[model samples]
Target: MGSVVEHKRTDKRTGKTVTQYRAHIRRVGFGSRSKVFATKREALDWIRNNESDNALTKRASAGGKTLASLIEDFIAAGVCQYASQAHLAYWCDQLGNKLVSEITHGDINGALLSLRTRGGRRFTPDGIKPSGKPLTPATINRYAAALSAVFNFAQAHGVIDAHPMKGGKVKKLKEGPGRQRILTPEEETRLLETARAARWDGMYLFVLMLLTTAARKSEVLNLRWRDLDLGRGIAVLGKTKNGAARALPLVAEVRKGLAELSKVRPINSDFVFYDPKQPGRPKNVDTAWQFVRERAGLNDSDDPVHRVVLHTTRHTGVTKIIRNGANLAQAALISGHKTLAMLKRYEHLAADDVLQLAEHALGKVGTGSSKG
Candidate 1:
């Protein structure tokens, strides 16, 4: 049982009316009632609401979870199954401090804006500094996407009422046009002959794999004999950037390179490209590559043609396939890109292709003649 009573009194110091509520709280023994409020309405409301023990318990116990708890739950669950564990740690660092209820759309926007302002540095172990460059739209969009995944999980579990990133759109910046760089037949012959004559151990095979199979440096370097099916002309990539496994078709030159590498592979190691000095580790050609570049008179790092890092081999492969008149869909599949948009970024027509088009359009014989 509860009783609500109010008394109007004057403060001796201030000489002002002080309205207070005194209630007879049953659970406690104090005179006849335990009084504790400055207003009669507030006292009555407390008396009515506190009458149910279950209601008090429900109010106190509900909504008790915090942002940190939710992030831990996400990490422990299957979220890190395919994605890098470091990425999970990064998300926790960025968004884990705020209370779940306190996070708003504006907070997410501020985080993304911060990323754009620090463009050059990756979200690595080292911190990102503000590059003072304008934010790229693609980068901003990726941040929005990563945030959406976390918030979507939060919403599904009732940690958030609705995802802050839900229905939010990011404006993408116009991408700069790609400059195509494809070697001509003469250049290709020269490059291949130079590779053969250079007589560097496995350098010939590495170049052949780049020009023929179009395998990325990481993929080619990490290639294991178990993943290769020479009979089927397939190289199975166990983990790819798209978070899926893919297979790359092997070409004749790629097969020849693999055959050569097979004779040189160590007995204990299964890596198709293992270095003898490193034993188990993939051969690192970084320093040796610079040496070769200098010897080949291709040391100008600033020149796009000479800027041919190890990755350029894969680029050459894609350009070759595209210049051979492969459709966008086929090229995308071959490259393991999730969409045609990414394939378009790698597409380069050879200079010979442009010359061929010009000859066809202008009619080579008539264009050469003055009709005197």
Candidate 2:
């Protein structure tokens, strides 16, 4: 059983009185449902759906398990523990009490669409700001993947007969080539100088380490004194996004910086990079990084067109690795990328570099290879 309530409120944008509808549903043992809608019809419609789902659950608890219980089991399984926990939580918050076996493709798609449109920073100083940027295909795909993992796990454990996301019922968006914003030598110089100007010792070294090893931000931030084998010029990374401990070779520039820091190191803290404000913990570079990025003129757009940011250092480093004569396989090994396809995606070719490759294919003729 459910009821809809109508209330009048002033619109933030229009500055006019408007009617808002709030629907409430109360079900024994399954808990209560409530949602606000712009129209009474919409509110009533949602109430009807809740009544239907609740009725179905009472009939037999759809395959003897609810989505809410599945989430608890899935969390115990720890498949998407950190990297994608929030994405999974978003789905669970909405659909948790529903039966996994009864959850349809439409259910998942509708939630994704609502998330894209309705997720906004409301009541800001500038009033309601529509998320200026629409979600990218890559981002949407990641959300799909997180949900897919949960359903797959549920099916594998015999909780469901089949998963809706499987067999192309819900298709992912066709993503474009990954972002590639390799820095020029001048830009690199300016960025390093700007980091120094920011006056965070960790920022300068971290920037150098990123350019040198092509390590992810979290990878470098987790580094400790014992993690470095400076004499051998390699770093052993115990914790990584992929859950595999691997080694990243230290380039001369990074080695030089690390060597300088090692002499003045504090024995009290084992962390290689520390916040001067807190010596025991890993350095908090966010504020210093913001300053450095602005000073270095970094763009913060995820427009999928192209932009440079701290993470762009990985793209830049990988491009330089391949340009400096590392083959695709070698580049993958160095950057710890699992596949050649991923390695190639990180290798952004400059227009001039492509022209040179064309020139090389055509063969070098007179006086250092130029035609007048």
Candidate 3:
């Protein structure tokens, strides 16, 4: 039921007279708030629309949740089983402040766009480059996913009728260039020699792991000694990105590298790669790796590989495997990517070469029919 009441009142200081109509509407879950109008007809119209919006808000509130409340609940549940707390915290910070009723698809799009605008940045601990760097599209995609998950979770929990994010589209930015810079045979030898000559103990082994397994630097650092099954010739990766446990076989050189690491490995820490200076701290070899890159004499001011960091090794490995005739599925599995499409991006061949290979495989070798 709804009612419109007319009233006359006087202003306090100015003492001006006023006549107004106040619409009183009954909400299913929330109490009424007075809406003022100039006339009875306008007040009635106001009540009609207010009633509809109030009903939606009431239903959402009935389950003891609001949009904002649901997001906090999702974060508090600690549902990101495989994600680092810092990662989850980042998403929480991004979306936690908005009231559910106030959020729109535009807000979600803006957040992703902001991430794209900033390249990628790393923490220095010394407060040097506080902004770090702009983030990659892949990284931005992860944040978008997390945001989507939160909104979806809210809808499922009855906090909202539909996820604003589910039907919405985000303009995906382009993926960054692959870190794969295939080392020439001579360059590969020189890089290894340089790593061997490094003052660091595990530098040689780190280089070997990169060349053999194509494991990302972070993934390699996260590896535990127990993850290795030397007899089976496989290294079980229990913790990598994408929340899947994968097994990587040891190449001949990888096997020898692990054997060497076993001799000098510390019995206390569980890590296969640990730092000596930061004892018990798992090796974060990026800084040491930069030094190795410089010593190799391959560095230049304009080279993309200069900013390549250590993940380039993983990229290099994947490229070499594909070049050596490994199947896409095999490379995807070894690289721990969720899709075959991602593996295709790692192969650095020219567009013509791709067409040529497709034609040859499809029995249309020299013909342009493959493109068609």
Best TM-score among the predictions, by candidate number: 2
Query: What is the number of residue pairs that collide in model 3?
Result: 9
Q: Residues 1-372, candidate 3: write the lDDT tens digits.
A: 688889999977889998999888765556444667888899988777766774646654544444456656776875543444444466556665666645668877876776677565555646435355566666777776676677666766656555667643555556667454556667678788999988887888878887788887777777788899988888998766776779877888878878877887776777888877665788767667777888886564444534445666777778777777788898887888888987877666423357667655776545766543
Model 2 Cα lDDT, one tens digit per residue, 1-372: 899888999988999999899898776665455678999999988887768864546534445577778877888877653336667777878788888767889998898787677643323445556666666777778888888888888878766656888867888889977776678899899889998877776688899889889888878887898999999999998756665678999988889989999999887888888767678988867667778978887755655557776788888888888888788898877787766876766545644576777676765665575652
TM-score of 3: 0.67
TM-score of 1: 0.57
Candidate 3 backbone collisions, by pair? 118-134, 118-135, 119-134, 119-135, 120-133, 120-134, 120-135, 121-132, 121-133
lDDT of each: 0.64, 0.77, 0.70
lDDT, residue 26, model 1: 59
TM-score, model 2 to reference: 0.69
What lDDT tens digits, residue by residue, belong to model 1 across residues 1-372? 788777888998999999887876454321122446887777888778766666434333323455556767766765523334444455567776776656767776676666666554334235645444564565456555555666667777755555656554434445444334544466555556666665457776666676676767767777888989888898998887676788988888788778777877788888887777776888766655565555555444654344656566667778778888887787767776778887766644454577777766665565566431
lDDT of 1: 0.64
Question: Where does model 1 exceed 4 Å of error?
Answer: 1-93, 99-103, 122-162, 169-173, 178-204, 243-245, 260-271, 274-310, 346-355, 358-372
lDDT of 1 at 108: 66
Model 3 alpha-carbon drift over 4 Å, by segment: 1-93, 99-102, 116-120, 128-139, 149-161, 176-180, 277-281, 301-307, 348-372
Q: Per-residue error at 98 for model 3, in Å? A: 3.5
